[model samples]
Target chain A: MAFEFEYSAKNPLYPVSYLKLRAMHSRLEIIWTGQAENQAQGLAQRVEQEMLAMEREFNRFSEKSPLAVLNLKAAMEDVSVGEDLFMALELSEAFRRGTRGYFDIATSTSCGKDMVSYTLNPKSHSVRFNAPEVTLDLGGFAKGFALERVSRMLSDEGVERALLNFGSSSISALGTHPYGEWWAVGVDHTKQHGIVAKEVRLKDSAMSVSGRNYKGEYHIVNPHTGASVAAEELILVEGRSALVCEVLSTALYAAPKTEREAIVSQYDGYRASEILCGDCGSVSIRKIG
Target chain B: MNRKEFLSDCGKIGFAGVTLSLFPWLQSCSDKAKQEVKGEKARIGIIGTGSRGCFHIKHLVQMPNVEVVALCDNYRPHLEDAAQYYPKAKLYDDYRHLLEQRDVEGVIIATPLYLHAPMTLDALSAGKRVFCEKSMGYTLDECLEVYNKRKETNGVLFIGQQRLFDPKYIKAMSMIHEGKIGDVVGVRNYWYRNNNWRRDVPSPELERHINWRLYSEYSRGLMTELACHQLQNGSWALGMLPEQVMGSGHLVHWLKEDKRDVYDCVSAIFTYPNGVNMTFESIISNKHFGMGEQILGTNGTIDLVTGMYYSDEPAPKGSGMHQLIAQIESGVMSNSVFAGTSWAAESSPLAPGVPIMTNVKVVTGESTVGAEADGSRELLEAFIHATITGRQPEKVLEESYYATQFALLADKAMHENQILRLDEKYKIPYTPLK
Candidate 1:
């Protein structure tokens, strides 16, 4: 449950800098390499601003957050939404359909079978909840969404080498490490302290790791069943899209074993791996395409 | 990050990494020792029950592989306070009495700077493993004597050079040695505190006994007490010792009211074999800077205390993908596995440096006695493992010996105001512990 979120460059010779902040119920970190100090500071401030904007828009726990306001008003009538919120809803809906409802943002317990919990009005830029009990939560989706945006921001800023990580779960890497071919990261064991479950090498890609935390409490819920899934294995998904990786990791972990490959097959250039700790004191890694 | 991940990260340097380099002795500091012991406990005895001694006791009680068999202190209150942690352990007023016990397999000497050499020598001679606190000795002669005694007794001796066991230092040192920060330029070390460096005395006669650090006879003041730890940074990063040392000391602040003869402000500069200078300065008047040890290189700087690296060069103006493409076209790219992502416009150029290792608790060195996440606990754990396995951690004694000499020599350089080299008599051949 206590994960080690460490990022290192191989034999790095250039000056690498990073920015750390608390956002969206997680610690958000951005590391920029081979950049001048002033440029890195400017770029880091921009990235921080981007993530903060998204966090303010997506955070439902805050009373003044846009999501909370929408959740409260949309049930009774169509509520106007901003571009960021609207985009997040559209992405969530797409992933929900892509994962066959396994990645639902709207709690399914409040909706009828085979029914969409909320309707998005593109023309009016508004959302209306179909059911009175419908509540929208982006706790699992915001990190990925923010990482994807930050990734694009770094790409846009002409930053060649960088790493962005959110709460040790959502991660994005641009270019290779200054010294090595890839940015190396370790997935910590879910049950054992300090034990590395998997070592993932990433370059120009993103990865999401999902599992029960230190207390053996599952954070990912099965959107279809409306209950936390009890998975013994840690699920890791890596791909070019940070958003896709985050959605798939959560969906695959919540879904049953038989349906994981099918769900992953829906996405291109993505790979999922199930890390299991065996009684024989060895880690068993099964790769899925 | 935990022990394994930290050690594993430090394992990968471009050249000879910290784990695989000169300090081969750190093998015992890893978690492998816990596995080797197989739940067996190492019987440990404490010679002093001051703040640092209790600090060790705090770590000892938590360790499942260590048992506090004996506790000794001349002060009854201190002994009683420490006994509360492990009431089962026998208590003694005198350390010699504690050393006589057959059950005490190893002893942790945290009495004072002056007592380190004598207690360590006695513990080793008594057929017990010794974990002596730094500086290794009160004087250069004592340091040499203790070094020779370890060989004479063929005993397992662990010095309090905790940086060698710290994960942040290991990671930073690895990066430094790997040319991450470019060629080593210079080393800057400073410790600033605002306290009077005094402890409450129960009676009038116990002033020197309670406040040992403020006296020349009992301690080397700030040099041995503080600078010894930071002095190791230059040698560890450059892989060589200083050739000469010169400095000045003054009783700047806490002067008239106290009988303390030790200087409150001291500055020493050590010139290495490569002609690079390592500077040390401690002032008790201000606590603004706190404490910091930095290794300055041509390309960048590494703050060993805070574990951050700052670069001297300016950042490039374009995207990494674009830079990679340019490098590829120019045939200057060293990274073979390059996949181009989207390239874009340039941003403003200014940024704060990154931490060498993330998730580590960075101590600001405010606590005069002990600080958390400062490698003290791990150092004690390594010593306990050494005692249980009967294997001496190689090069630890040499490092501690030289660090002690630096402190003592710096003191001499300050008092005499002349540059002093290590006496040929004190130089000992480096040997790996078998």
Candidate 2:
């Protein structure tokens, strides 16, 4: 929880008001650009409220939280979940298969200890654990899920020019910056201070950056080996879908280097860039198909 | 992190009202506490207006709800120079006269090491809050006396341990306490400087008064003057005290012809209760590796001075794709992952160290005077808040006490040329490493 990602607005010359809030144990910032100042302010407040609501609903820390309740009760019997929770689980299941079980929430429930087996019933909007150890921790999926909802909220509210950044990792942009074709977001150099290893331009798209370095050792564990990934590279996935990019970024980062290209290829229109840095801050970026 | 974002993080990271039990002293730093101390001016007096005093004055003059009501010093020039910042303040040649002023509710003592204990005791007895510069005292007994007096008087006391109030340190310590770097194995601290550390005196009679840091009677050499701050790192990161200490000191660089008995170089190794060794080495001859405190752990190492962490586990190298990219960058065409099935698995132990905290200005420990954003201003602000509220910060005196004790013991060990064990009487009730 002490880990934080840095956020920098590439085009500072553009006119936009930033709405900042704390959610999901990290900083969430929304840069809103609109003709009416009052409208934008109102939208910022609504977005903050919605994000806090989602945080409360999905937070595993609170025993009474929806996610916590399901994690606690679903092991014994089929526990019905909310529509949002069900959708998140279904999407996580699809990602699990797509990433060849590399991106799994259940294995991380107890820090990769004990095998995880769970089944999701879409028709009943419920989940049942086949194994007693099959607890679900949605930490890897929550940010992306929340970003998708924020994207929907902005679209329904007729907001076209907005940027949603959750924890500086899960990001979704509704439109381009006022001055440029797309909003320019720089990827922080894994080792060097004040250095941007890569700059990603996003226009009506989403980007997700995942790495085990920022959060300390063994922060991200591989489900296959139940051990932390020792790779120092940062995996950045940018695509049209925030959810897909988020899942792919984490999956590709945790998967073996050989399977990365195949895992990324499973998702359409999504590209993953592996940022490799030498000892002296020399960065090499490898793109996966 | 900026102030706004930092406070937002404090709220979100359970430092707000939710779970301040971890860092109870930080309760005053919360946004809620910020609102509580609003619109309350704290009248303060400066006891010693030298360079360090002037540094505090610079921050004091800029602080809201803080008024410099008095200035005092035996040296007229320093006092007069500091008076320029607060012309309305009453000037006195003696600190006792300044303490007598009813309006001055608190006193900041940035005097010589020998004077810290007596001045703090006097300020406390005068029913005034006290903020004393560190090396709590010239001797361990004095430190204990001053510490016990504060308890008896129930007066507010703040030491010049700025790292406690620094954002990066706070964040790093939070991670450390949460086992981010894993079990702490060793603590390595060193301060290297190239200068003789002598200040220019305007008059021959003022030589001893101006450069008190080089004298044995007025100072405890590098241990008290410099090592005091570094000695506290081990206890803080581990929440346990060193069991014994042994070391050696000698004038390896600056000779005795400079008219100083204090050693120009010294090295000490402190054995903690857990058998972990915390080492301190300082020399005035070289500036390489300027100054740093590294908390070595099983999994990683935290460079507190630079706010960086180097994990022990090396990063596994990328596939042949990285070679392809490097070749393309170097303007060489090569058949890469698309054409090659043969690859080598490689790992590099020299991975680029990740920064523990960003956006905050980290100090390199080169300043003789205080450095900016080094928690000096924030510590002063916290003192002002304490003086206004009439409440003491939690665990501050305990930490200052242990640091002073460590330094004093190290000095004694070096002087005796034998390993010294901590006396049982000095131990206090405190938390231990889990």
Candidate 3:
């Protein structure tokens, strides 16, 4: 589970540090400055170890993975869950309710039964299924959860200026970049290569982007319809935490334009922006909140 | 009867049917029959003693029936380097002189792209069997001329398409033909590398000659060098050629100080007669995606490079006893439970790939050359066997012709920024020998 890393010298004077690796089928990059080479190496090793542990525990593809096991048996009986899994499930329920059911974990296309068929018991720290066909999938929120955890760990280790990018979809910044006033992150255009549709500055905020149309097909499924969302727009959300940003981005992308503002207003200090592609191939970007 | 006579007689009554029905008979032909058919060792002369030529020499020197008799290169340094390995072999400044050597029965053409067709045609016309490394020619006209000349001559003509002889590919292709993955819906292939793709130039004068792959006059860049193999795989798997191709390419990344004319990135989609599309991508800026071919089918997908086939159907669920054990391991329930509903989902949303040829053990490391050797060595062995036995399979030439045609056409499509339909006249009409 130790992912491959590619390191390159970002600069000679400041000696910027950059490390890239593959996780969850996408590229993850960690860039930082203001630390000695040894300290940076230690921080990178800890980050890699933490990320691998998270992947092992939550990766749904692995047959022996804890998430896979919980998904396999949580419906038949009350399955005793690990603390991490329990916390993730709890956060997922909160996000689902906060987004008015737009951000759902139990309503996966793979789940044949309805979301109401499954129940989580916080008192016993267990999950149970009311029906046999209910299932839970955490792919929508796992990366954000892992990113937030690693960022917190890095902060605790006294690492100050850093950028943790998870697959270019979810990213959290520790502090301002060394060379710039703030971390200047570009939101990639949906159709054009290397085109930045929008740029946002992050001092300590986290951002997540969700789009229904891009390369091949829309993989983001609408939980209410049990079908893929057909909108050709990208929704970008910035918040105080990675989890909230991840949840709101996905929810806003799937929600109608009229309801997106309402979803963003529910959280404090969170804003949402959308880049919509019209039928005639014109593009427009606007802030919804 | 002699092996040639036997095979000739068998060829009259459907070569495919004969190869199938007389499989045991051919196996029973004995060592004496094989020796009688394969009279002498095949002496091979290598043209263009560069990296690819040296690679061929390394494998050919190890082959039992092949003797590396001559080495040819216009560059003295490359010739001197190759001569270190084959000290006994004759060295030539010109390939025509190498072709004139009477002792050499066959030649391996590993020169640059521009020299492939002319060298192959000359070697074939000189009554020497030929195995030319692919992107069969520099241009479509040159490829067509080589094909026509090859058909005219009685000598065996084989292009270096090693994947056709690979055991993994053979097995996967057989399974695909047997409907293991159902009908092929599409094919996707990509090659990525993070390098300048330029060799160190000895001097500025020899830049174009030494780095011919990056020059427009000598090569078609990624399409001819990389996409040909994958395009051939698409055609071979589908048993038909692509009817049209549309593409876009740009020299986006290698633009600042690099003098190369070839595109740093290119992508194309080839449409087959059955409406199935095969997409190809190559990039020199980023190596994130690496390289592989994904053969997508209605029921499954096959990663050709990895030799793994992923079924659309999910893995079977654990049994009731197994589930109970799993539940107990997690301290969920220890006692006998009531018969609950079967909460197990039928199929997973994910695709877990299984190996196509499980018997072939995978070897990892720089020294482990099993996978690479199996394909190239098998191809060279086939060429040598054909030269010695005076029998070359017709399918090799036919495949070479069509694959080169598609590759060059794809290049044209990208350059012209338009869709190109394959002309029937470009198709080499020849029946494949089973």
Model 1, residue B347: what's the lDDT?
19
Whichever of 1 and 3 has more lDDT, that candidate is 1
Runs in model 3 lying further than 4 Å from the true structure: A1-289, B1-39, B317-320, B323-344, B359-371, B430-434
Write one digit per residue (lDDT tens) for candidate 1, span B129-231.
Answer: 9998888898899999999999988899888888877778877877787788998989999999999999999998989999999999899998999999999
lDDT of 3 at B40: 62
In angstroms, the error of model 3 at A266 is: 29
How many clashes in each candidate? 17, 0, 0
What clash pairs does model 2 have?
Answer: none
Deviation of model 3 at A231, angstroms: 29
Please say which candidate is ahead in TM-score: 1 or 2.
2
Q: Report the TM-score of chain B alone for all candidates.
A: 0.89, 0.92, 0.85
Please, what is the TM-score per model? Answer: 0.56, 0.59, 0.56
Binned by DockQ into CAPRI classes (incorrect, acceptable, medium, high), candidate 1 is: incorrect
lDDT: worst 10-residue window of model 2 chain B: B337-346
